[model samples]
Target: MASNLTIGQRIAWYRRRRGLSQEVLAGLVGRTTDWLSKVENDRISLDRLSVIKSIANALDVSLGDLLAEPSLFEWSDDRGSHSIPALRAALTDYRQLSPMAVRIGQEEPPSSAGLASEIAEVWKAYQSSLYTKVVERLPVLLAEAHHAERFSHGDARHAALGVLGQVYHAAASILTKVGEADLAWIAAERGLAYAQESRSQVVTVSLLRSVTHALLANGRYDAAIQLTSDAAALLDDDLPKATPDLLSVYGTLFLAGSMAAARAEDRATTRAFLAEAQESATRLGTDANHAWTAFGPTNVAIHRVATAIELGDIQVAIDIGPKLDTSALPIERRVRHALAVAHALSLWNRTDEALATLLDAEKMAPEQVRYHYLGRQLVLSWIRRQKGKPSFQLTDLARRLRIV
Candidate 1:
């Protein structure tokens, strides 16, 4: 008699058949090898429906196939037209309907083409939404499309690479904001690799910038500066005069270098880098002549405020912060809130006020808020030690944010 197999056992068998080691499979699915192992061994359960779908897709099996027992299938009337192929078809149908299923209380029928288009549309919307500096939902959308197996063909693979790169970049940013620098670094590196494979020079440049940002977040100022310089040099000027993508990339790199220099306390170098960024921003036009038209004056101003905060020039940060029209800025690039709050609190010697500002920023987006909070906490801790009591609420905020 054939033995009954749990989902974990089925996953293990299919994984081995696909000739993928746990580590390799885990990387593809953005999971840790240990977690995959535990799931395979039944030591842990797959509670998230998304994880289950991802596993099924990676194994090229149906959810039912993974759940079915060999002996029971042979003995049941329900076995008619219930081969792996049929089960796979059904699984595809279910996965395609996932997004709609997640929305209203209605159960919609699935369409392969419709699912692909929906995924593409949602991905574009997510990218657009990044400018608004809001993105707690991007990761979920990317993961859903990833598990839906909506990206298997050549064109789909290219799209997947682009989506995955953006997802990883966003994930890295969120992780860094939450003070998970190590995890952020890993995600950024993975994103950069995928962007390169997609041959999307613009996306690759963005991913590289993200990596530099991660390095800076981790206090690796020198490394971040070096990486930003290298990325800048790699931008080919011959690409196209109308290509704002390359120009936008250069602007971002310059901003990164400026931040790094500020961290290193090199005032002259920071000013020089900021000047370069400003010049690049000025050159960007409304015509299709630029590679990334997204890097406008607002973006430059946002960076200026950030660098000012980093350099401990509270007055400059305060002056520049309000000048920025954040309404035009991307959701992902909204660094002003933390910068303004931190600068005001620090300069006014109102540590309590600064802590509150940081807390407010955190409430906007915990992941993004953590970046400002970490720096503020470091400064506050030193100040508290010098004084009698711990005035700033860094410890409390850190605990609430799960940073400690």
Candidate 2:
């Protein structure tokens, strides 16, 4: 019976099976009965990682159990699909290789400048909604960058190592989206280690952002916020000398910290960090994709949509939805922003529009929009609400996502 329930309904079932009343379970998790009731009714989304973990612990279930669907592709009960395991193996194998193995002089080395161009191309591909391509290319890119770093010296070695860190950071992000939180953590840690080796604050911040995201995915909201906050504190004395890139990185951390706070239900902290980030965005004077983060005024607006939805401010999210321009963002950013709008539209009883918005996201990034757990969950909830037949669009999406 629990296996047939939505995540919210499953929570209620688990609480009842565990012989805990809503009030008792709420008290156990330090939440009010109203919050618990809303969650059980699916009136509010259980999006916060901390909130999900609390429910899991109080119900004595694992996170995987809480999120898993009978339709296997809808969610992973383990480390997701084979893609994640393969990605993990690649990272592990790369890390374990002997230094001598990477110094391959048998083939002509690509020019450092050309290798750098290829790295940019990879980032561009990722931003353009080529996640599968990015994942397919990463292992080789990482190996080549490692080999390049092993044979180079001075600025060449430094640049090569920086590229290595960037590739690892991208790997962490891709892994997280594919539902491999554990592997994503390792990728992020490795990226951070490589960043430290490069001794670049910009590189460090980029990797740190990925680490924070992986932490969020793992329900370590407090630690994620603390890590980003501590890093932000380190930049205080150097604030006057901060370049646009540094300021953008500072803004990126604040944005991430804001998300962590929102996940923890700390609205005050969320707003405070958002304000700080807005100041930095203002300094940049435009919505630039600094350090490939897309952190700027327009980017903040997209986050505002997400934050509003997370905080159950459906009206707020709806109000800000139309102001976003799909053109101002990369394809991935557009998908993210569109998903937030879809969430808002879904909650506002605009189910048709919500489904349309989701379809738009699918058109942009077919694979990502198809496999994401939240979108599938939301559609399933809607399907359950249908009096007779589900709409064809929703049905097709569910079929594609394997949630039927």
Candidate 3:
């Protein structure tokens, strides 16, 4: 019975199932009964992750149960139909359990240089928001990275391990983007393990950001914050001599921390994390994408807007979001920032502008606009609110996103 319902309906269903009235559930989540009634009636959209998570908690339900997100692969093009399954196979490959088996190198292991080149290509595709390309390439890359790590010797082996770590990091990132939170957690942990094995402090710390993201996806915001704080602290002693890449990684951790803190609704901690990230960005003094971190003043500014949106400061986000230029950032970052701006506009009841912003983002990264929860929820909310016939633009966007 719950399988064919919208999130709001499912919430109402679970509320009734738990023998709880609207008032009781509303009080549990710190919302007025009127607000809950709007939610249950689908008059209001639970678009914010933090708010949705709180409601899920109050209902004693998993976030996934509440959201019922479809697998990214299920709706992807034919070329990517098997990507998720292949990636799962690679991640859970039995050969990884037997170092002896993996070291045999059934095929010649890619050289450390070759692995690095391959990783760079995948990262470029990912940052460009070419998610389909990234998904298709990663399964093979994961298999080869493991082979390289197992087959090499000494320095080469360590380099291979670092490459392996990076491969896992990419897997984790894409998994999270696609709503495969559990798989993302596994990939991130595996990345950290390989990074530590290589004894690369910078890679290890950067991979912690991946783990933190995976944790955030699973609604473990406090854990994400603590992990980010500890990881950022580890970089302090080396700051003076740190390479740009290391500093990028360091600053990125704080940005991630800011996000986690914001999601947790800890305004003070969020501000502190943002301040630390800003300091690191100031020291760097320019926008850069070292270590694929994309950390710098502009990126920090983007996070500031994002965190404000998360903290329910729509006015603040609305004020700063539209004026900023994000051309220097990667397409992925640019599109995500656009989504945040659209969210702020939507919340402010500037529906036309929000719709325009989202359409512009779709032009740049249709895949992101399609798969991102914020974008999907925003469109859903707009469609739900339409009276009689919906606007052509809204209907077209909804069809493109396959959300209608």
| Cα-based lDDT for every prediction | 0.58, 0.78, 0.87
For model 2, the superposed segments whose C-alpha errors exceed 4 Å read: 1-5, 9-27, 30-50, 60-65, 68-82, 94-112
RMSD, every candidate, angstroms: 17.0, 4.4, 2.1
Model 1 per-residue lDDT tens digits across residues 283-375:
774222233234666666777777676666767776766455665544435444454545555555665666665665566544344333334
* lDDT (tens digit, per residue) of candidate 3 on 65-149: 6765744554455674587878888889888757666443277888999989999999999999888788899999988888888
TM-score of 1: 0.55
Candidate 2 lDDT, 1-404, residue by residue in tens: 42345788888878988999999999998989999998888777675455687788888876655665322222235423444445567789845356756443456555567677877888888888776666666777777777777778887777777778888888888877766777788989988887878878898888888899888777778898898789888889977788888889889888888888887778888898889889989988988887887878988887777887777777888998856786877888888788778878888888889888998889888777765666777787888878899988788887776666
Best candidate according to TM-score = 3
What lDDT does model 2 reach? 0.78
Worst 10 residues of 1 by lDDT: 67-76
TM-score of each: 0.55, 0.86, 0.95
lDDT of 2 at 350: 89
Error of 1 at 339 (Å): 3.5
Candidate 3 residue pairs in backbone clash:
none
Query: For candidate 2, which ten residues in a row score worst on lDDT?
Result: 70-79
lDDT of 1: 0.58
